[model samples]
Target: MKKHGVISFGEAFIDYISKDRSNTKFTQLLGGATVNVIAGTRRLGIPSYYLCRLGVDESSLFVEKELAREKVKTEYCVRTPSKKICRVYVYLNEQGERTFHSYINPTPDEWLLESELQRDLFENAKIFYFGSGTLFHETARGTTDRALKYAKESGLLRAFDTNIRLKRWESDEQCRETILSILQEVDLVKMAEEELLFVTETSSLEAGLEKLSGLKIPFLLVTRGSKGTYAIRSGSGIFVPAVKVNAIDTTGAGDAFMAAILFGFHEKGIPENLSQLEKYTQFANEIAALSTTEIGALTALTNLQEKVQIFKWF
Candidate 1:
């Protein structure tokens, strides 16, 4: 049995999603990539913890309640006296695609920075996951930087999701600089096609791979929605097509994908062989595609039996 767990650091926000832009009947769901990943981990019975801040408001209260219900350890979650909560408005198209209009809270997520992060949390864990959004600001960025530095020094497996939300940053230049800095510390890097292009400043996938080859990240997983996921390490690349599902909402699919990838990595005993890596990516893509079948994130996970059944189709 794997005795370790995962510790994640990022934001926890509320998403207001609507099909019609003029309607007030929007569905309210939790909307932070880190939080969503933690939820998925909990559903898989993984011992996981999240470190983030929430305000003293109804949204915060609800989020706390939901986190507890999901069985994720909240010992590191900080509840501060801010009047606002991080928020986003998601708009979906007819094709189940999504675009967002965000309302960012001016408050910082660094309120938990002073709390002594239990070094044991990362020291004994199998993976330490972080992302770029937490580094978009100074206060939270400082906190995340310090924690990840600690995790790195302790020789923990560091995973980074280059979750690029262009609207959150001041400019593309700022995003590139901050994301590139985080890449230096990550053992595994997860990105989408557009993100790969943007991060590498290259027009083609081959060029992007060439640029990242110098980084020597142990594992690079690039997700191309619907078409499938691609995995490359050192010299080999493998493509895994997405499972066919009638997607209700694309929200949290990427987070679900990453969580499933982690689960598969743990369950299959992560291997260094190129063939083993390809096999894992195929399984991971199936889990991600299955997630989009339901409305909310992490609610409709494919169980062990279901996962086994799907592998036959692949």
Candidate 2:
């Protein structure tokens, strides 16, 4: 079999989900921004690898099991009992929307240094995925930079998603600068509607799109929940409508979208024109819509293989 070519480097943590229908009592679930994306890729039949650390604690162990179940290549996963896994307390509203309150600060993932990243994996990957969570701290920021540097030197395609959590950033200015810096280097970017406003410092969608044109990223995918995605690739623009579904838990919908998009890129090279982008974006939208029909990120993904058989790519 051929080796997987997609690798994601970032934190992975346990989420204590509020089980109460009213959002009170809690239950545990695997939750990490980047991990969810990696899992989505694997579910979409894209061979992927996860690069991060985990301890022997129960939470860490749970993550280990989940990754194995997801079949993401874990050769780059480091094990150490010295640092415990990070934790996030997730509260879900009646609408199935969630708010995250994290605990166990400064956990093992924050300590992921450059030396820990696998140079060979970085060198071999066709596409490298990243989230903004690690850029908040100095240690991890330096570590992420090294991995990004490795990907760049190796000439691998780099993708970034502005999965911003205000609580994780040091300051608004710091968040803007760090994200923009990475944005400058990546071949593609995925941003939510609000993220587009913040990153472009614009109040309206049209203005934001105009500002993004300056970056000249080969592909800038701006996802508008329910409204669909806007793709700006090398100045050409295409809008793909969102697929409607009964959203139960939207926790990892964006990750699903990111995974599906990156998977499409892994399978097909960069879109040659708007028509090509529209086809891929439509398929990705369906992938993301199906993810929300269930409570967990990877829960509803078992059907992707079946869905792929029916949906032809253009």
Candidate 3:
């Protein structure tokens, strides 16, 4: 068998999205930043794998079934009775920007342990991707650390997305420290402009990049919604403008952008120069813009596959 594709590990949950600002009616859909990345990659014809500990609840079942339907391999996912699938309430404002209202978490401490990670999966994958969702807890943090170690040892490319949800962490300082701890280990990292500022403890984007320049990260992406994404490779930066779209919901746009970047890596390997990086960022921006034309994260991705030839665009 050939060693290929991406392996993602993190939280899997259900998102209850409000119909409007009224907050009266909501539609339940599969969500979680890491889940969106894995599913999005699969939708774009990348062989993807999801690794997480799932409970026996109906929500967990929904996540598993949906991942299966999306053709994402889940053989590495663990099943237990104690784990509870998390639920997040999302409210969309008039501008299609989403605000996470609240979270319903029954087992915040129950997470996949480091010992339970299957090493073979890392050995068989070309890229290993993750986000900040699961790093606040001890068990999940350990698992993430171990997984990264395995990925490095196996010579697999490591990618990190600063999908920061401040509500999940104890404090802003803790979130910054925890996320920065692993920056030196990853080959690629993606962050929104605000996230860049928050993590770097700087007020401006230029200051954030200057702070981040001290680190050895090979590739850094700073996404600035409509203005575009700034791709930083070996300290130099290039701003790639986003494709204009009437975004209906911007919930999973970042994950879509990430999935596109990972797909490019899986198919074409890491960008050799700044020009290649810019092309990849442009393709990612197109996908991200298209994703916002629908409601939910995964929902938007599914609609994108039907409306556009996703694989051909790359």
Model 3 regions lying over 4 Å from their true place? 19-25, 91-99, 303-314
Each prediction's whole-model lDDT (CA): 0.77, 0.82, 0.88
Kindly list the per-residue Cα lDDT of model 3 for residues 214-240, writing each as its tens digit.
Answer: 896999999999999999889888999
lDDT of 1: 0.77
Ranking by TM-score: 3, 2, 1
Which residue segments of model 2 deviate by more than 4 Å? 1-3, 21-25, 92-102, 106-109, 310-313
- For each candidate in turn, the TM-score is 0.89, 0.92, 0.92
Which candidate ranks first by lDDT, i.e. highest? 3
Sequence-dependent TM-score of model 2:
0.92
Candidate 1 displacement at residue 257 in angstroms: 0.9
Q: Between which residue pairs do clashes occur in model 3?
A: none
lDDT minimum window of 10 residues, candidate 2: 101-110
Residue runs of model 1 more than 4 Å from their true location after superposition: 1-3, 19-22, 91-99, 106-111, 114-116, 302-314
Better of 1 and 2 by lDDT: 2
